[model samples]
Target: MSRRVLIKTLPLHSNYGGILQAYALQRVVRDLGCLPVTDTSKPLPLQRRLRRRLWDVRRGIRMSLPARFDWRWRSAREATASQRAFIARHITGGSFVERAYTRRGRALLARRFRTFVVGSDQVWRASYADLPAQFLDVVDDLDGDRPRRMSFAASFGVDDIAEYRDGDRARVAELIRKFDAVSVREAAGVRICRDEFGVHAEQHVDPTMLLPADHYRQLAARAGVAPAPATGRLLVYRLDANDHLERTERELAERLGVPSLELLPTGGPSPSYREYAQNRSAYDLPSIEQWLACFASADFVATDSFHGCVFSILFNRPFVVYANASRGASRFDTLLGIFGLEHHLTSASSTAVDERVFAPDWASVNRVLDAERSRALAYLTANL
Candidate 1:
């Protein structure tokens, strides 16, 4: 069988977690002695693209208003330059193929790559415009034996899929059942696969956790990211903004006696709605290496992002998780549960910060991480 493998996951964009997970997976695969190429060829459907453009246009009109206009606000492309550059250098570049769903495309893919991996993110989520492509449906035309199909840490993103159309749910179930092996990132995902898709899936840590913190520090060094100067700063990385999360951040900062440093704006209701309010430099994404350095150097961390929590734990940084119910709270529940730090999960309404988060038992946490890392590596080695 050809050692070349193709990876299918959500398209690479500015989401730090999404990009890192793709890079981590490809790195792991290459270390296991296989050539991995992520498939970035899939494009969003015409309708989805149109809807996004319309939303952008409306936002542009609003930002253009005299009261809201800021001369320093940067364009989206300019803001995301560092992120896209990292993707080109480490994740995907000229490897992005044209449409691979046609008959000829499938034959070429089968001939070129022997394995297809479809996960480590919310690729199974029903609302994605390109749901079939994420499920590796492009290979359906080829004989099953030619290309092996599997998913590592695939996630549905939400516990419930009913919000999406029934046809999409049924089709996803059908496609999931055909995979040769399956693993999920969250505990709830295991249940969802068994109950909803009638397929049993083992649970594994997110691909990011499979690598140690030293690996990221080295990567940051190689990228010319300066070593973080010692500081008493509370790093706050949240995906969504609400009064509760704001309160939590304030309270945590008070308890830690450190000033808070927010890297991303968790806009009101939407992640990007308040983008114009910040200066142009605020909009520029920190290089992935710098992002890692933040987690590594923080005295205390409070975030609503799943990857934020993951990095905090990986770096052994004392931290708290403000539950992000929208993105999927189950991800937090399962992750914290594994290391017996469930008390660290807080909500918008929680009255007090957990004293436990101020001082985690790093010795115990590291032991659990080691075990989980070994389990995840074994799964990849055995399956791949």
Candidate 2:
């Protein structure tokens, strides 16, 4: 029997959370004694390619602005160098099959791999181009010999399917019904899978939480470059900027009496992460290791990022999440609810920063994490 497992996920890119989740899933699969490969090959539609080229022309104009205003500019390749390096070193086995593959080509893939695993991100979300591919429709196209299909922590990125077009919802519903097993990252996803898709799904923690803090700390240590030690510092990571962020940061810093280290070259937590890549100079962009290190070393953390909240809990750093409604607040709700830390979520308009926000019960949180980690790993072992 072929032990090769093809993981269908959002293409690995500069987003720290997305990349780390991809890495963590592959790592978990390797430990489970299967050869895991992620679909890192991104195939953009021609229309998108053309649109991107047009954006590139506008970005060039922006890049040409005076150093006083556009000082952070660096080629995208240069900015993403460290992130690419980490992926190359730790994450491997890229599958490049596109939608245009021949029947024979897909048949060959069917024989070569026996299991297709999808998830640990918003793989089910409608905004991404390859929704059917994420659902393992490529494997279904193989006809007589189809591999087992399973979703591990897949997400819809929204609470309901009302936002999705009728055609997309019906198509997604049809594709998802064929899965051997389904699991999602958020509780709302379970409801969606049941009510919308008419398929049962278990809710699991994100793959990043499957590994121990020591695993990430070792990754940061070996990566050779890190932001300066954030020990005793407040780490502020925000994907979306709002009028209230500055005041929130100021208040947190003042209350904590610590300097703040903000993750930068910032523009995302976007579904496509293209905004971050397009808008920032490479020099201003932080490496994946640097991003992980901030969580590892920080005394207190504040952010509107879901993964930021995940890492703070993973590393047991005292943190507050400034709920990012645009990026799916349900993700934060589900994740924080799992650990009984729902109080950690705050907003720009939220005036009072509770004393408890600065102090999560690490002992209790770790207990929950340990139990949840066991459940997650067991799901992989049983299903795969």
Candidate 3:
């Protein structure tokens, strides 16, 4: 029997980490001949899903596709029927809420899903958090049959689980207990799952980094964005309203004396990453292949995203990630620590360093990651 994974993905919101996580899971599932189904549920309700779907359709109509593009063709179509069902649920009204619970039709559809995966992002966050929708705490209901319970790479955005009051912690632990195996994307998350939620979780690199950078380069080459010329250009990707991002980038650009491609971004954590594609110039958001090619092309990279930093390291693109006053830095710290990448981050007020300064014998990182990936694959495959 094929195992059906009901995946809860963070809304695409154009973050590369979210995209990488979903695709990585799909790739691993494909290797196993098991279907991976996605359900992009944030903390929104049915009405919001309805509103968002309408908005997405309007955006879909206004947006032009890449030349030789066909929306109907999908790498996921070859997935199992269960996978298709999950996608349908995920794509529903652009909200997983409407797909699974907001509507009678979708609720009926979700009832048939046997195995569920709670995460690859911040799925445990409550409604008060900024996520678009919340998981319905159905782990208990789903656990009744003792179904194959697992969590892929759940992340809690903040480290202080103590901030929650009014029994939220109880709900969180209750929900976490239903899982048979657990893993998290960050060090704080590993701590939270063990200390707060009472689940033992191993730490792993983001799935996007699991595959080599060359693989993404091939994808980019297929998509047709030529490698960036060696023009000493800096690619700047920042979405947060960090007070000093512009000043730092400007300072860095002037110091490097290279024109920078600033990615002007817009969008929340939603189901479509088109927000990234939309806010960013078409030049910035290339196809996966082209994105990799550009990674190859960059003389240096500057950004504050985890996956952005990951690709930079994968290509050995010299770079630095300026820190933001946000809570998600634990994942950044964990991954960087794993690779001994301590020099890549600095506080916003610090003097800007040339991004070309990265130098580490990634030889150690490569060996550790390769071994971990192999063990993770063995674990996932054996349980299935």
Candidate 4:
């Protein structure tokens, strides 16, 4: 029988990078000769769900006030609908454990899987750190037959552990010590694991980097993404859209002489919940597969998203990165440094788009990527 692994991370929702990373992580696990399953269970209780709805309704009413009315909220809701449709169509190979938070649910999960893997995103951030389920605490407590616990490319989502509250830091440290093996996505994460927790953690590339570019190309094709433009097109994917980024993209498009396209439904945790709730639009949001196709089809890509930068490199497209300081800049810095493309990094304040032109030495970058891949694979094989 194949060993079964239950991989848990952020829920699959509107976030493109989060969903794609979850998919990529499963693919990598399966490549290692194990069955990887995502926990798609909606663990929130009915009361919590009701309370959430009431909160959203209340917020929506407030936002609808004549003085506060904004149209972006409508766009957000429409984008969310499109995102859900995309996930339903493209995401597969997963099993759901209903009511996974209950005693029976917990027992069912323990009975069904032998290994639990947590990570590939900011699962270790302070917001989720206190949650026992995120830490696989129930699995750890399984009597005499606990499954192996490991983390792959888990990130703290910040440059320092000090960013977490004192109580949260201590709790996170305690939970992390229970893992059989731990690998983080950033050098800063490694430092935190060592300096704060006294646990040494190896840094690995994001799971999205484990697969080849062609793999994503095929996914795009499956999603029915149209062929790339005959000449070349400038693709802009900015997670945090601002006037500065907008100005930069327009300038780049003018210089390159290619039609530019912007991926919509773009916003992050920084936006108010009420704003996102009220946003509704008919603009079709691309599925994760379609999103990959966007990158694959691009002649040049520009963005402030870490995955945007990663996909640009994976597709070998010339690209520029605007630092997303709010989301965490270390992720971009660390990944870019690995490929020796730190020169591509720029700030929103800078007007020039590094006009010298991008010509990455793929041969050297791939060599470094290969070594990192081996390290990541070794960690999984040894721990699992």
Q: Write the per-residue lDDT of candidate 2 for residues 1-384, one digit (tens) a residue.
A: 439988878877788889999999999999989988887655456687678779989889986775345534544545677888888888875654553266666766766677888877877777754756677666666756656889999988878766677877788889889888898999999999888889999999999999999888888888775644788888888777776776778888998798887777543322123444455542446778888888888988888888888999999998888878777778988998989898887876677776787768999999999999999888889999
Over 4 Å off in model 2, which ranges?
Answer: 42-74, 226-228, 266-282
In TM-score terms, candidate 3 sits at 0.74
Worst lDDT window (10 residues) for model 1? 265-274
Candidate 2, position 209, lDDT: 94
Task: Report the backbone clash tally of model 4.
Answer: 8
Q: Give the per-residue lDDT digits (tens) of candidate 1, residues 50-135.
A: 78779889879867665434433435655678889889889743233344544565567767777888778777776653766677
Candidate 1: C-alpha RMSD after superposition: 4.9
lDDT of 3 by residue, 278-382 (tens): 443322333344445555777777787776787887877777786653646666777778777777776665775644264556677678777767866766676
lDDT of 4 by residue, 247-279 (tens): 878888898888887765444432443555455
* Clash pairs, model 2 backbone: 79-282
Instruction: State each model's C-alpha RMSD to the native.
Output: 4.9, 5.4, 7.7, 5.5
- What is the TM-score of each predicted model, taking all chains together? 0.87, 0.86, 0.74, 0.83
Superposition error at 151 for model 2 (Å): 0.4
Better of 2 and 4 by lDDT: 2
Candidate 4 positional error at 324, Å? 0.6
